[model samples]
Target chain A: MLEHVVNGLVLGGTYALVAMGLTIQYGIARIMNLSFGDTIIAACFATYVLFSVFAINPILALLIVGPTGYVFNLLIYRFIMKPLVARAPDEGALEVDSILVTFGLLFVIQGVLLVMFGGGYTSYSFLNSPVSMLGTVVAGNRLVALVLSLTFGAVLVGVLYRTRWGMILRAVATAPQSAPLFGIDTNRAARTAFAVGGALAATGGGVVSMFQTFTATAGVVFTMKALIVVILGGKGSVPGAIVAGLLLGLVETFVAAYIDPGLTLAAVYTVFLVLLLVRPNGLFGKA
Target chain B: MTMKTSHAFLLAAAVLALLAAAPLLIPDYWTGVLLGMTGYVTLATAWAMFSGPTRYVSLATVAFFGVGAYTVAVLNETLPYPLVLLCAGGIGMVMALIVGFSTLRLAGVYFVIFTFGLAELVRQTVSWWEVNITYTMGRYVFLPFEGRHIYWQLLALAAATFLISWGIGRSRIGLALKALGDDETVAAHAGVDVTRIKLLLFVISSTIITLVGAIQAPRWTYIEPSIVFNPTVSFMTLIMALLGGAMRLWGPLVGAIPLFLLFEWLSVSFPDHFSIILGLLFILIVFVMPEGVLAKIETLRKGSPK
Candidate 1:
């Protein structure tokens, strides 16, 4: 049980990092990037390829992955999102169109990755030996992921809270039209927030590369999880994402450990159903 | 009926008659593919019938399709195919009504998630059900009909679905659905029975979709939970409908045939990476022709500076 919880925390922390990126985009853009996972998965595959071929340091993989994610989202915003925004005159239409566009985006990314990576699973192992942690045996790479994720979470939260750019982002998220009136370039801020979302995707990809073997389809599953986390945590709240992320991590791990591991997604769906019925606004989402 | 409605009816009947007879004229290989293509057309048309009018991006077609497939797998041996198909469709209706009522009251996004969750939920339940009870993980079905017989059966189903869709597109409920899709609040204020219409459409669409799956299951010979509940199947139907023109009566067939041909060609050309080509195509469709190809052509005909 202790081991499961410890492992779950690390998993949750990584998911939280991913969810925070989604949260920022949703906060500002009010659109969920379902293809967000594509970037993360790309980062994973790119890191694995780089390590295998270039003989690069595994620990420094994020340096490559992070910028790739950033550029990927920038492309998305430029090519896909901007056209969608131009076409949609209303929020309802925007919501539906964006969802469909992202859904298509999801498949496109999955297909491209499948072409690049095939169906084979690739993984990176940092320290294969198990480390004893508070009487629970855990893998060292998992521990590294946990530590890195927690640090990333702190730095992310800090950046959002303490930075001028973060404040500008918040203002634009709250009031896109009025932000420009207040001398804030809402479009630039929104684009920057998307880049931040991409960085989170890269961090998530690195975490997965460090701890688990992944295929092209692996990131699709994360999109579902991260979307659920964002919704359950509240759309725009980083703190809410962390709380919900940890909660979901515990929920998934404990359920998978105690029950059949295959039913983890079913359990998450059940949680989503309950959340929709009980609290659509989410735990920390503003009205 | 108006001239336009009558014209649509005649066109549908002609297409149905031709399809109903063409199995003999075409080669078995092409016949088999066309039969399967009709199955997708049925799924896509019915899906668009429900979703396009409501503007609800439903992900529950997988749930209904899987349920229909599995229901037939477990019960088809004891029951006649027709009765089994009915039961399967009835089950789909029940599931749709349950899910639709519970989730449709919320926002549109919630509906999307609920449908998505329902698909995953149904898939898991089917897997668990097979593991615990079925003992036979892969159910080998003894379908009484041969390929051509099955082809005709699927054709009838496809035609029936198209006819129903045509009728609904002209009906008062269809108008209400289209209105609701544009703006729910306004539709409600305009005295549209938004919930009831949406629910009814949900049931109608699920029934046709489920029947298609149940009917198509026999063609594959072996039924498994994983194959039956695959989300890709649903995505293809959804994408086809969107690619052709979700609101147009000809959308499903127009989209299904060409895309199926394209998919076959791609599979043969680059079997391993067809998914990539498909994904790129889907993205291209969304970007270049959001209203679908038919819409694009119509615009070209009317709006182009010739």
Candidate 2:
């Protein structure tokens, strides 16, 4: 039971990281950044290539991929999101448009990956190593991943609360019309949010790939799981996502271990529905 | 004669004529593609009936389609074909009503997410059931139908879709849906029973989709959880609705047929990157023509006064 609990915490850490990225983007940008999953997939592939070609250490590969993801997010915002942002605020709901556009981007990325990498699953050897944790054997890579997720999450909370940019970001998220009056360049703030969000997502993906094999189509599952975490945590609430992710991770782990693996997803979805029914605005969300 | 009524009839007749004759002219492979496209068109039209006027994108349509398929599959093994189709549609309508009642309080993105989460739940349940249960709850049972019967069944479904779309387009409820889509707050102020209207549209749309799924199952003679609950179906329907022009009577059918043909051609020519190319095309369409091809043509025609 303790082993399962540890495993759940480690898994939850990864989910929390991904969910934080999603929540941040949704909060500040008002765009779901559905392609956030693609960033993770791209980062995984990048890490894989670096490790295979340059014989780089896994930690070093993560450092390279994280920044690459940031740049990629910036590019997406500049090209795809910028033009749409300037349009009439009420012309159409941005959420639907974002879903359509980002889903299209997902398809494009997945297709490209399939063609370049083929459909087979790939894994790194170093990730397979295990470590002893208080007599409970834990995967070494997962341990590293948990630490990184928790550390990054703490840093993000500090940044959001302490920094001036974070203050402007919150202002912009609350009222885009009022933000400009306060001299906040809402566009710039949104771009920065997207960049940070993408980096976090990429970091989580890089860490997760250390423990699991993934293919081109793997992004869909991650995207779905992240969305669930975001909703369960309360939309736009970073702290809520952290708690929700851990809870969900524990639930999924227990379900997968005891019940049928097929039933585990169903159980997670059930919890999501129940949460929505009980608290429509999410656990920590502003109703 | 009212202009809207005349225009709707003309559009319906044109669509009917096209669908009726399409199989005879197209190749066998293309016929199969067309069948799939018809399903998309049917689903898109149903989606539009709810979303076009209300501006709420219900992801639960996929769940309805899945339920409809499963219902037909399960029933056809024991019951008559016609009974199976009716039961499938009835089941879909019930599910839609339940979902609509539950989530109608939420609006905009929240609604979308709610429906999406619900659909995911349905999908997970279906997956679990398929894995654990010994007896098949959602497997396709073949009804003995030949070429002409299949063609006629498709035509009938298309005709029903056209008539229903026309009715919705002409009705006050349809106008309410449109008003809701334009601005929910204003629509409510204008005396529209927002909840009832949304629930009614949701039930109507799901019923049509379930009908389509029911007939489609027998035509394919096989069904599975993945194929029935596929997000691709939702995406394809969405593309068709947007491409043809949402809220327009003939838009879905027009968009679906051509898009399916394009997909078939691309898949045949470049099987390796077909999905990628299709994705790019969708992006290009959004960038260049947000209103859609049909809407663009309409704009051009009006501007030239031809």
Candidate 3:
């Protein structure tokens, strides 16, 4: 149905937004960042509190949450991730170390959140009114979220593709060994990219809070979903994230609507497995 | 055997004999706690057997484990206990073979996530089937296993896991795996059958994990997808193995006993803050001793010349 299509796009938009952040971190910074979802969930809870207690609009909360995410991620990079980065014998060692470290970080953030928020599902009504679009009625907040997601995605793509800073980042990501030869501060680029990715995750969380119910423990679900999108989109490609995110959303929506709803997760994994088996490098990934 | 080897063997036999008699000497409450410790020790030891040398860091420990638990849960009533255990092992082996062949080619982050995804996929599929076909959320495990019986079973399994790990470390496959872990392409060039060694080790590790799950399932009384397929099991096994020094045969045992005790104490004293403490410990462990406690000890010993 047309309604399902609209819903899928809204879901896919958030997926793309989060996947972009993760791709940026993994592709450029070379940190697997299992805690990325906890950051997103933290932003969601932050937006919730701001909206409920301070009476700030969710859109306005983005201004506060996004920068906090950037700063928090930067601090984590400086404090926690720096040592692992320093002693890594090779890229493979770094990957293993990052995965273990971030996996620990995931529990740390989740534990703090659980302590602060009593392990309950939290959602607040925001822009609940439905608006007619095309031949279908859609929630006002989801539509706004989609538009915001697209706008952010577009701006990021433009920055990455059309700017010198983006060029340096791309060069570092593609060839870390040779980036130093070109006078690019690969370390600085990696830190900034990781922080920016955190900002995007926070922004995505704010967008999601407008329409979704979330729990402190649900961060892993978002992490897994974003991971799937990132890998499917080709690890570091922004445009690929957009396409793959939307594709996953559509597939999930369609499977839920046409088949049994309980099979949605299974369906997503099926698509991911088949794609991985077929193209280990992903659709747009470089070998 | 060498004199030192025979001495080590005698020491091990004496310790195991003491452990076998522990249940009769200890109170019922402590027997329960020891049972939990043995279970984790078995799982952790099996996990390190493959992950340590290969550096593959599999997160699918629960996948095979859950399969083993589910197999027993379904077949226990129809079949005898030993038969159910055999079936569980058989099913786990087949699944491991399928998963290993398909996925051993991918390494690093890709393999890690793939195993994780595979576990989640199995969990979701089982959950769906239970809801739609079985019309039940969980199954009752009515095995007549006492605390001591399960503990002894797990203890035996843990011993077997250690023996297998020790044997493998001395085998040609172990050397090949070590080479592959250092660099896959070079190992391949050096005529190591990279895929076969990986598959063999992976299957062995996974089958042991499956048996552990089967042995431990009776203690739960009720089993479900959420309980059996909990990702925490995977994470905990990885942490314990790595914390002890996965590369060493006895490292998992060294890691599991202390961490298990710490967790038990944390949960009892500060139930609400248990997760927070756990997280901090994990972070501290990885940050301070990424190579693990044994490795840290080795460095200290080297620094302090005897």
* Top lDDT hit: 3
Which candidate order results from sorting by lDDT in descending order?
Answer: 3, 1, 2
lDDT tens digits, residues B1-306, model 1? 256866866886897788788878988998888877888888889999988778888877888888888888888889887898889989998888878877777777778766755666777767876686665687867887777887888888887887788788778977887788778999999998888888888889998888888887887788888788877777788789989988788776789889988877887999877666676777788778878789899999999788
The DockQ leader among the candidates is: 3
Give candidate 2 misplaced runs (Cα > 4 Å). B1-34, B59-61, B115-121, B135-140, B301-306
Model 3 has a clash total of 0
Q: Write the per-residue lDDT of candidate 1 for residues A1-287, one digit (tens) a residue.
A: 89999989988888898999988887887676767777788888888877888888666877878887888788888887888877888877777778888877777778788777786887876677899999999999899888888888899888878999778888887788789988997778877887889888887888778888888876657877888898899888999999999889999999889987778888888888788778888998766
User: Which of 2 and 3 is ahead in lDDT?
Assistant: 3
Model 1: what TM-score for its first chain? 0.95
Which residue runs of candidate 1 sit more than 4 Å off their true CA positions?
B1-11, B116-121
Give TM per candidate. 0.94, 0.92, 0.97
- Tell me the tens digit of each residue's lDDT in model 2 across B254-279: 78878878777887899999768877
Query: What lDDT would each prediction earn against the true structure?
Result: 0.82, 0.78, 0.89
What would the C-alpha RMSD of candidate 3 be, to one decimal place? 1.7
> What overall lDDT, based on C-alpha atoms, would model 1 receive against the true structure?
0.82
